[model samples]
Target: MTAARSSFGFKDVDAREKVRLVRGVFDRVASRYDLMNDLMSAGVHRVWKDMTAARLNPQPGETIIDCAGGTGDMARRYSRMAAAVQARRGGPDARVVVIDYNAEMIAAGIEKGSAPEMVWAVGDAMKLPLPDACADAYSIAFGIRNVADVSQALREARRVLKPGGRFLCLEFSRPSSEWLRQAYDAYSFKVIPTIGELVAKDRDSYQYLVESIRRFPDQPTLLRMMREAGFGQAEFTNFSGGVCALHHGWAV
Candidate 1:
């Protein structure tokens, strides 16, 4: 008889099991996720996210899907920006949809009442349930690294986007300066999990967070992957001395 399979995040787990384990981590950390992020990044993550939004340059009457947009931060920002653009242009009808695989995350977003223009839903990035050419823009903020199959998720993002739709991903990346890299690594491996223990009371999840960031592909590699996924032009800009990177591309 065959032995039973273990789950993902376990050394013995198969691919599918790994995906489940990763999803479970987010679900477990949903409520305190934003707090942990602030604690871990010392509130610098907000600056990084704001920089990412600035690059997106949301316009009026456009639809955006923020894949893995936990707690609806990105969605809320985009909706507001779009609304402001509409106000200036004398037109209305812009929306931001926040989709995350974890229901707990969606619940938190809904409870927070992110924005009336923001819609929260539970969905996976790898296989979005939306129709083709539906979104004018797509973004995944600080969440793609946790995905079981990142390449597949990028493809799905491309598939759901309209021609000329923009794609942006803001994620943890390799630090540029040697000193900063060493310091960041030390903080991620040690200080982060310690903060998680004190703040979220979930050190294991925080430890996994550091591991997942270390395991993610670097900026250039990710840009290449995006191009391979059929993005017309792919490029990236590093932030925080390379502790984070923003990758942007467009469907053609």
Candidate 2:
């Protein structure tokens, strides 16, 4: 039997090969990953991230895992928010863990230095390192599409969360408006890769990134996947007219 095929941007690749290819993509962009984010979305990604965190609303004593959490951007936000809640409520401090398959991305995140509450590990979205029912919340921002097995990743997320644990994902999605989709497509295809070339000096990597976004499942399909993966209940909110979407799931 042949192994399955996965999308590496618009290109179809052996499923087993995608992990290595995706790793290379992040390794090349790790150092300037945050910078390129600012350039690519003109800093709109920041607001989108904020919305993701707000939805999660890191609380006191909650163990939050940011899967494929490149450069610990979301983890840091979680740490701060969780700490604030702990301070006000007078309880155990929350743990914000950053897990990613790419070591270089983890290293870049470490270079920025995070709070003591933050823990960093190199791990896969499809097979996280933590034990079952260990986390109170799990989030992946713009990272799930890179996984060769998104369904497996969803199951792992279900596996690792305690009952009632929340799952949140924020990723680029198909726009609801035809005109906006056309404009976004034009910008994503022509401009983002060029920005990568000028800023990150790696056009091909950013090209793959944009393509991966296009390849990711849109809101409704992903919600169905979540429900099938044992998330009992799931829903999504379109951000910026569906240019991006934030998905929420509850492990029952």
> Would you list the clashing residue pairs of candidate 1?
8-17, 8-18
lDDT of 1 by residue, 1-252 (tens): 554443233244555776788777887788899888887888998998888888888888788999999898888889888888888886767788899998889898888887767877889898997999999999999989878778899999999999999999999999988999899988888798888888888889888888878778899999999999999889999998889999999997
The CA-based lDDT of model 1 is what?
0.86
Query: With candidate 2 superimposed using the best TM-score fit, by how many Å does residue 112's alpha carbon deviate from the native?
Result: 0.4
lDDT of 2 by residue, 22-46 (tens): 9999989999999999988889999
> Which residues of candidate 1, in runs, are more than 4 Å off?
1-12
Q: Score each candidate by Cα lDDT.
A: 0.86, 0.93
